[model samples]
Structures are given as structure tokens and as C-alpha cells.
Target: MKKHNYSAGPCILPQEVFEKSAEAILNFNNSGLSILEISHRSKDFVAVMDEARALALDLLGLTGKGYQALFLAGGASLEFLMVPYNLMKENGKAAYLDSGTWASAAIKEAKFFGETVVVASSKEQNYNHVPKGYEVPADANYFHCTSNNTIFGTQMKEFPNLDMPIVCDMSSDIFSRVLDFSKFDIIYAGAQKNMGPAGTTLVVIKEEILGKNGKTIPSMLDYAKHIKAESMYNTPPVFPVYASLLTLQWLKKLGGIPAIEKINNAKATLLYTEIDRNPLFKGAAAVEDRSNMNATFLLNDEAHTPIFDALWKEAGISGLPGHRSVGGYRASMYNALPIESVQVLVDVMKDLEKKVSKTRL
Candidate 1:
């Protein structure tokens, strides 16, 4: 049986990426040393790091003049604190949009550092919709938002237009669509989703936004420090960086973000259409706020759960379970997930309907 994987992060990567990465791990770039054995400071590794950062910026249409791309060791979770540390000035405030768990966590982290104003929030709706038309404080240092909420299956389809700098955590849907890079002053994401494996976080920041916090920052936590050093202030996550570079190369070959966005929309449409048409299933998030990356749905009858479970498992499908906070099912159709995998899931849904109809006879 051909297996299909639908896990959210540390998720599926291209087969070619895995194959080439494995080969390079043993003897990278035809050099005798393994990728693991290569010194991060070595010229070859420096080139690798430079190219990876450059490719990421290029993919996002970022110009090096104002923007600096860094591959840092700490995940986006660390960025939840680093963002406020570098951008939030003394006696200054930052605005946040509380969409889901990660967004709430970021707000909590920012409070420990300085004052943060949650201008808008969706907790009242169980995070099923994005908050709209919030008032951004004119004195605010930056406005922060999570581009997509994985657990709640909601996304910020349109960002709020604010005069202040915009800081975004694009962890779930960074490269899944075309974004106007100019709108954001800083964008960060963990590479595990839609990029590559874990252990590295990518941050693209506008230089002017840094060095204004007026607070002494730890070297590792300072964005200005990393930007000035070209993300080489210390040894980096060499292997993950290399893999991320390869993934970026693959994305370019596949016609970049625009092409991928078309396919991503199609995959989401296919699954959501099935959910809407089926009597046995219903989508969890609001129609206007539904996420294209993570599609959450539920069985109409709780007793039918066992049947839905067996249907996918017997068909060699996997990782369709929803997060514990929001139960039912979540199909994370990340970039590397081929459209065929989604078709297979849809087929399973149709089969389940047929079985249920027979049971009613």
C-alpha cells in the first residue's frame, strides 16, 4: 500500500530533496567529509549559509538594502520573545492580534519584556475567525500577527493596514502563497513547515526596525547582532540550513510561489468541497476564515468516528488527526503534499458515505 502523510510540521518533504540530502550527508558537494563533519566556519559551509539566506530573500522578493535574512538556531518560539526584545522600545508598546495558541503565546512572551496591546482577538469565537478592524495605536512600535493558525484552521486572509512596522510569524503558511513583502517589516518562520526539517528558524527583518529598543539585549537574542554578523555570529544549524537551501532550490524549479499557490488553493478546495457536500462531515472553521494550509473538519456523528478512523487507516492514509485542543480531523496540506494525496483522502470520504448509507438501509 502506498502511504500518504499529512502531519503538520516536521511534515513531508520532496522525495528528491530527501534522496539528494542523504547523499550529501555522506559526502557533501563531492567533498570527502560528511555534511555533519564539515566545520560551520569553513568556506564551503559559509557559501552554503549565504546561498540559503539569499534564496529565501529572493523567494520572498526581498531586497538586501533594507532587509536582512538570518537562519537562527532557536525556533519561532524563541522569536516570540526576540521580536519584542529587539523592536519594543522602553516605555513603548506593541500591538498584537490574538488569533490562536501561538499568537497568545507570543503575547505572553512580549508582556514579560514590555507592554503589549492586544488590539484584536478571536478567542471569543474559539479562534474560528480572524479579528477585523482593530485600532492600532499610533505610538506602537510594531503590529504583530500570526499569518495562519494551525490548530484553529484559520488564517489572516488580509492583514490590517497599520502605519507602524508589521511583525508576522508566518510559521504555517510562509511560502504557501504570494505575499506583498513590502507590507511587512519583519517576518519569521520555523523551517519545519513548508520549508524543510526542524532545528532552524528563518527571520527576514528590516534593518531600520532594529537597534531602537534602547535595552541591553543578550548577544544571542539580539536581531541587530545577528544581522550585523550576517547570521554568522556563531556556528549555525549546518545540516538543517543545507536542507533548507535544497528545498528552496526545489521551490524555484517548481516555478516559485505563484505556481505553488495555485496548487495549494486547488488542494484545499478539493477537500473543503468534499466536506461541504458530504452529509457525514462538516468543516470546523468559519467559511471566510478557513485556512488553505490546514483543513479541519469533523464527523457528523461521534459514533461514526471509529468508522472514519478505520477507513483511512485501511487505505494506508495517516496523520489526519486534529490537535487535542480542537478535536476531529486536520489535514495539513503543506507544500510538499502532492494533490494526489488529497484526492485519496477525498476518495476515502466518499467511501465512508457509501458505507454509512448502506448501514442506514
Candidate 2:
């Protein structure tokens, strides 16, 4: 049976990437040494690092733009603290927009370092929509936001144009769509979603923003240290990084973000349309702020959940359960997920409606 993967993080990656990564595990680059056994500093591995960084910058259109891409060990969770540790000064304030769980976590970490102000929050509405019309203080060190909220399935449709530096946690949605990368002073993502496997984090930072904070940052958390060492400050996550590199290569071969965006949109549209039209289901988020990456919905009647669950499971669907924070269904459509899988989910939804309606009659 063919399986459709909708798992959130540590999520779906290109099958090609999986195959290549598996090959490297046995014999990397015909070197007779597994990627796991190879030294990160070896010339061959260095070349891999160089190419990966170059590809990331190229795809983001930040090549030759004074931005440095670093692949580090900590996931986005560590970055929650690292962001303010390096950017927020002893007295400086940072503005945050709370859209979901991840964004709130970021705000919590920033507060430990300095004044972290939440300019706007959708928590009052259960984070169902992106907060709008909030002012980013000119005096704040930077404006931080989570571009896509995985748990609540909401996304920031538009970014605020602020004079201060802009930082984003793009863990779940990076490389899924095209964005003006230059607008952000820093962008960080975990490798598990839309990139590759877990164990690595990607950080792209404008070089000038570092070294401004008054408090001393730990070497590992310091962006400048990572950039200076070319992301070899400590031994990196070799396996995950190699897999991510392969995924980036696949993305490039598929015509970069512009081409991928169209496919992602189509997949989201197919699933969302069914959610709206299906009599048994309802969307959890505001339509305007719905995330293209994570689509959250719930069944109208709790009694019918088992029927729907059995239907999709029988159809060979995996990872359809939503987060415990928000009980329902979450369909995470990452870059490599094909539109066919989405259609399968949609068809199952329609099938459930048919079965339920006939039973009622």
C-alpha cells in the first residue's frame, strides 16, 4: 500500500534525497568511507559544506548580498534563546508578533535576555488568525515573527516593513515559497521540515547585525562565531546536512521556489477546498490566514471521527492527527509532497461525507 505522509516536523523529504542519503551512509562519494565515519574537516566534506551554503544563498537570491548561511547543531528551539541572546541588548527592546506556540516560545526566551514586547497577538482568538495593525516600535532592536505556525495552522500573510532588523523562524515553511529574502536580517529553520531530516538547523543572517549586543553571548550561540568558522565552529550534523544538501539540489532542479510555490499552493487548495465543502469537517483557522504548509481542521461530529480516521488509514494515509494543543486534523503539505497525495486525502473526506449521509438516511 502506498502511504501519504502528512507528519509535521522530521517530515517528508524528496525520495531522491532519501535514496542518496542512504547510499552515502554505506559509501559516501565513492570514498569507501560512510558519511557517518568521515571527518567533517576533510577536503571532500568541506566542499560539501561550501556547496550547501552556496545553494541556500542562491535559492534565496541572497548570493553576493553579504549574507552568511550557517548550518549548526541546535534546532529552532535553541534559536529561540540565541536570537535574543545575540540581538537584544541589556536595555534594548525587541518586538514580537505572537501567532502560535512557536512564536510565543520565542517571546518567552527573548524576555529572559531583555525587554521582549509582544506588539500583537492572536491568542485571544486561539491563534486562529494573524494579529494585524500592530506597531513595531522604532526603538526596538529587531522585529521577530514566526512565518508559519505549525500547531494552529495560521501564517503571516504579509510582513511588516520596519526600519529595525527583521528576524523570522521559518522552520516549517522555508523553501516552500518565494519571499523577499533581503527584507529579513536573520532567518532560521530546522532541517526536518521542507529541507531534510532532524539534527541540524539552518541560520541565514545579515553579517552586519552581529556584534551589536552589549551582553556577551556564548560562542556556540553567537552568529558571528559560526559565520567566521564557516559553520565548522563545532563538528556539524553531517548526515542531516548532507541530506539537506541533496534536497536543495532537488529543489534547484525543480526550478527553485517559484515553481515549488505553485505546486504547494495547488496541494493546499485541494485540501482546503474539501475542508470547506465537506459537511463533516470544519477548518480551525481563519480562511485569510490559513497556512499553506500546515492545514488544520476538525470533524463536525466527534462520533464520526473514528469513521473518518479508519477511512484515511485504510486509504494508507499517515500522520493525519493534529497536535494535542489543538485537537483535530493537521495536514502538513511540505515542498516534496505531491499533489496526488492531497487529492487522496480530499477523496477520503468526500467518501466520509457520503458514508455518514447514507447512514443518517
Candidate 3:
């Protein structure tokens, strides 16, 4: 049986993308050259990059709305600093919502640039719920929030309407759901998640948001420079970008974000319903704030852990263990994760429950 991959990052992609990517590795576009060895400047590769960027914006409904998508290197971690570097002035402050580990890291980076006011944090509660009623400092340069907390399985369902620019790190749930992508001024996600592979990062910026911060950003960190160069500033992550383009193309062919959102919701619902309905388990995150991409849950009895683990493993479920910081399980149901895979896990949970009931009686 094939394993149901649930790894949070570097996760599953559509099988068609895998097959197509494999073919491209051997012969790309019938050019008899590998996509891996193609120059970023080549017409074929450029078209790939161009389509990837445009399609990303198109999928997000940001095209013709003044947003430019760039596939850069260094991941979302790099964007943590690059965001403040390009958006915040030396004296200006930024507002952040501390929802989980990544959100804390982003706040730490912004502090180096200037003041980083954490409007609200659910850290005290182990980041099991999205913070609410927090006010973004109206005078701040930008308000930063992570759309989905992959670590804690909490997602921000609604964003604050702010006068300042809105920045979001949507690494784990970029194309898993539909949203008002235009509401955000800057949105960045690492390719390892829903996008494609790990080498590249997608940065979607509203053109109006750039060059406003009176700071001399280094060429490498400046979004404006990358935008001016059409995301060709320095050598890009060739293979990951190409793979990401394949994923985006896969997404587009599948009816884009809106269509995928429904499938994602169904997968999440299937697994989460079992987590809640099963007497052997309970969700780790707030029910209202539970993530549609990653669902964190725990066995009600530690004594059952051994058998429960064995059952899922026997059922070919992989990457179900939770993050080190929070133990239990994290079912990362990304775009490419089929509903059937989710059903497999749910069946395992039901089987475990039935066994527990039989033993108890």
C-alpha cells in the first residue's frame, strides 16, 4: 500500500506533477535538455518562470490588481527579514500577531528593524487558538500575521482591516483555500508547502506597497530590485521554481484555488470529524480556529499510543506525529493529499476506537 504522507513541509504534491516533473528531468519540452540544467535566461526557462509568477497571481486573483509574484530563494525565513527591510522604516514600527513558532520568529526579525508590537499572542495557551480582539497599531508600517500555524494547527479566519500594509506568511496554506488575496499588501510562502518544493519562496507584493519605506535595502533583500528584474535578480532556484510552476499548473488545471478549497475543506472535515467523534482522541487546537490544512490531535489515553501508532503505521499512514514542541499527531492535508488518504486515517481511528470499546466491555 502507498503511504499517506502527512509531513508538514516538503509534503505531497499531485502525482501528475511528479510524473510530469520526472519526464521533464529526462527531456524538457522536447528540447532534449533537462529542466535542472536549463539556464534561467533561456527562453524556455524564462517562460516557465513567467508563467509560474503570473499563474500564481492569477490563481490568487491578484492579476490586474497590481500584484507581482516572484519565486525567490532563502524561503519564508528570509522573507521574515526582507519584509521589514523593504516595508518598515528605521524608526517605524510593525504590528504582529503571535500565533505560533513561525509567527514568533517573524516578530523577532521585525524587532531588529524597529519596534515590533505583538498585538496579541496565544503562546500562553500553547498556541491552540488564534488571538482575537487584538488591535493593530494604526500608526504601524505593516501588520504581519501567519495565515495558518502549521505547528499548532490554528488558522486566522478573518484579518483585521488596517490602514497600514498587511503582510501574511501563508507558507502552509497558500493555495489550500480561497481568500481575499487582494486584501494583503505582501504575502509570502515557501515552496516546500502547498506551492511545490523547498528551494524557492513565493513573494506576492502589491506594487503600490514598494519604495515607500525610506530605507536603503540591500540589493539581495530589496523586493523592488527583484520586481524590477522580473524576479531574475541573481540566479533563481531553478529546479524548485520549475517544480513550483508545475504545481501551479496542476492547480490551475484543477479549477484553481476555489475548486481546490472545496476538496481541502472536505478532507479536513473528514479527519477532524473523526478526531472529535472518536472517544479515543481529541483535537489539540480550538475547534473554531482549527486549520483546514493541518489538523493537530492527541490520543486520549497515552496507554493506547502504542496500539494507535501501530495501527496507523500498519495502515501506511506516514508523518502523522506532531511537532516536537507539541506532541500527538499532525495530519497535514495539503492540496495534493487525496480525500482517500484522509479516509484511510479515519478508518484507522475508527478501528482503534472499536477495539478500545471491545476491550473495555
> Which lDDT tens digits does candidate 2 get at residues 1-361?
9999999988888889989999999999899999999999998799889999999999999999989999998799999988998889888899999999999999998888878899999998889999999998899999999999999999888998989899999999999888999999999999999888999999999999889877788898888888989999999999888999999999999999999999999999999999998888999999999999999999988999888899999999999899998999999999988999999999999999899889989
RMSD (CA, angstroms), candidate 2: 0.8
**If scored against the real structure, what TM-score would every candidate get?**
0.98, 0.99, 0.99
lDDT of each residue in 1-361, candidate 3, tens digit only: 8999999989999898899889999999999899988888999999999999999999999989989999999989999999999999879999999999999999999999999899999999999999999888889999999999999999999998888899999999998888999889999999998989899999999999899888888999999899999999998988899899999999999999989999998999898889988988999999999999999999889999999999999999999999988899999999999999999999999999989999999
Instruction: Report each candidate's C-alpha RMSD, comma-separated, in the order given.
Output: 0.9, 0.8, 0.8
Q: Which residue pairs in candidate 2 collide? A: none
Clashes of each: 0, 0, 0
True lDDT of residue 42, candidate 1: 86
lDDT of 2: 0.93
Q: Write the candidate numbers in order of decreasing lDDT.
A: 3, 2, 1
| Candidates 1 and 3 compared by lDDT, better number | 3
Span of ten consecutive residues with least summed lDDT in model 2? 213-222
Which regions of candidate 1 deviate over 4 angstroms? Answer: none
Report the poorest 10 consecutive residues by lDDT, candidate 1: 59-68
lDDT of residue 286 for candidate 2: 96
